[model samples]
Target chain A: MKLVVVQVLLIVVVAVVAARLFRSRGARAQAIRRLGVLAFAAFAVVSIIFPDVWTRLAHVFGVGRGTDLVLYGLVVAFLSFTVTTYLRFRDLETRYTRLARRIALDEAEVRGRLEGGPEH
Target chain B: MNTSRQVDTSGVWLVIPLYNEAAVIGDVVTRARSVFPQVVVVDDGSADDGAEVAREAGAVVVRHPVNLGQGAALQTGFEYVRSRPDMEWAVTFDADGQHQTDDVLAMLEKARAEDLQVVFGSRFLDDRTTPSLAKRLVLRAAVGYTNLTTHTRLTDAHNGLRLLRRDVVERIDITQNRMAHASELVEQIGAMDVRYAESPVHILYTDYSRSKGQSLWNSVNILVELILR
Candidate 1:
């Protein structure tokens, strides 16, 4: 029963992420992501229903346990997500700093002109 | 013939970035004004009357729209200085009243006499500016980290005082908008192959600066930024 609930939750999350990826407006990229998500979701559901199948698959990869494989994949996925998000934020911050600096310099120019000379 | 007497500061521009430093900005501006004629204070969106205070203290004031960090503020000042064709040398000074006018004079004179591009202040070069054991340890660690990363043998890595040619400031861009900029500045200087020298200067530590000092968490964050960047 617990395994069934876990599989349902995993499928729901995968569906949501895959839906977002589908709407991301890239043809080849979206198709590749959709295929990847579907494959993972199918694997998760099959592993939930047939626990021995996961063990067998894990053995093919020289792993002792299926749970460990899933855990390792989750760790890699989470780290990649974090690093990509951080890079995006850093780019945004650089643009923001440039905007702030431009505004500050413009204000100084106007103020300086109003005062009848450059700002000292 | 005294080379010191011949060192010219007629084209020097002083840039001071102030953030809610109404209490000490006036005194610092006044002191800096006596040595350097062209003083520009970048007000980093302070809530108080820091802009008015600095202006009244005889320095030109540039106001930012929002609270950016010191690095942004200094960049704004650099932009302002760059716009003026009369300026040739630029100095970044702290508004916390910790730096001395004599140090600025010394660095400026050195930059002029030696025809160097950049001059950094080194407190460790002079024993007069002794800090507490904890602060010293942290600074030493900072020095080690900066030297390792930047590959420059700097005696003091995080000192806030510097004198550089206006062209040098124009060449290197400041992206780290906070405390991390100090490390970034050293790294850029090394990368640009800019001729740089370190001068022995004294850093006065007061209760106010100690109270407003960076926390250990912020230091860790700075290290992460440096490493990641």
Candidate 2:
């Protein structure tokens, strides 16, 4: 009972902190990533406190064991995180590539003038 | 972009397309004047201080209040030269320094010998040619597209380096206002069955040219401009 109370309090704190941060940032992408981390932290605290909750939920779903339930949840979260991260990286990479090419072209034109080859 | 100054012995006249080439406008004007003798730099609604630079370079400046395309600049130049009896050949050059003076000489030579109305300079025809592989592919594609669409049957369809006879300058109607018009020049002229020639020219591809020019996605914008405008 005591452990459950602690878990409830920690979850509430996580939720409150996450909400505050999200409100200030307006659920911006960075904030959302941070929120995911905080959410996982809150889940960890909950699992540690109410050890029976995992097994109960797992059996309700006809899973073999409580650990299996937690493991399955983690696997799903990992996949989601990987996809989002990949998309974000790809977006950033494209933008940088464009910028780099532009700068390169500018440099070449300037250098051509300096070299005095007279090729326009 | 070549900065070395020379005397304008040739009776050739110059026309430049300007959007925001304020920094280099003076250089283009001065160098063109020293080499070609007569210069016309069109200010395509340059929000910057390009007008002042053009004047300093000793060019007859034509200002467009809004940013028009390079084709408009060429039109303005041609119109100006056609009115002037002293003007013989009009050279269409890029204000961005993609064109060099040596190519201008080659264009003049071809224009005079063939008694042709217009001469185009092809970068690919040059010995060293353009440096970038990506640019080579894009330019090749653009050339092929221009040849097929314009039926000009010229080697270098879109090269800016060209010397135009006063008669050709007076007649060719270049309606497209944006960058796509550069390639479209061949098509428009070909439709009229106008005569033209092409010779090798140098292209100095710097990082700036690639960046500031038409982008991969901008082709859609150009297509829409063609269809709608």
iRMS values for every prediction: 4.7, 15.3
Per-residue C-alpha lDDT of model 1 across residues A33-107, encoded as one tens digit per residue: 568769989987988899888667656656668775577558545654555456567778888878888888888
For model 1, what is the C-alpha lDDT against the true structure?
Answer: 0.81
Candidate 1 CAPRI category: acceptable
Candidate 1, residue A71: the lDDT equals 75
lDDT of 2 by residue, A64-100 (tens): 6888767766655655555555445645544543343
Per-residue lDDT of candidate 2, residues B1-229 (tens digit): 3435343435577888777878777876777665676777777668899877886677666665455466666766676567567777788888877778877876776666677777888876757665566555666667776777667776665578787777667776666666667766676667766667788888766566656765556655655445433
Q: Please give the range of 10 consecutive residues that has the lowest summed lDDT in model 1 chain B.
A: B1-10
TM-score of each prediction: 0.83, 0.60
Backbone collisions counted per model: 0, 14
Top-scoring candidate (lDDT): 1
lDDT of the candidates, in the order given:
0.81, 0.66
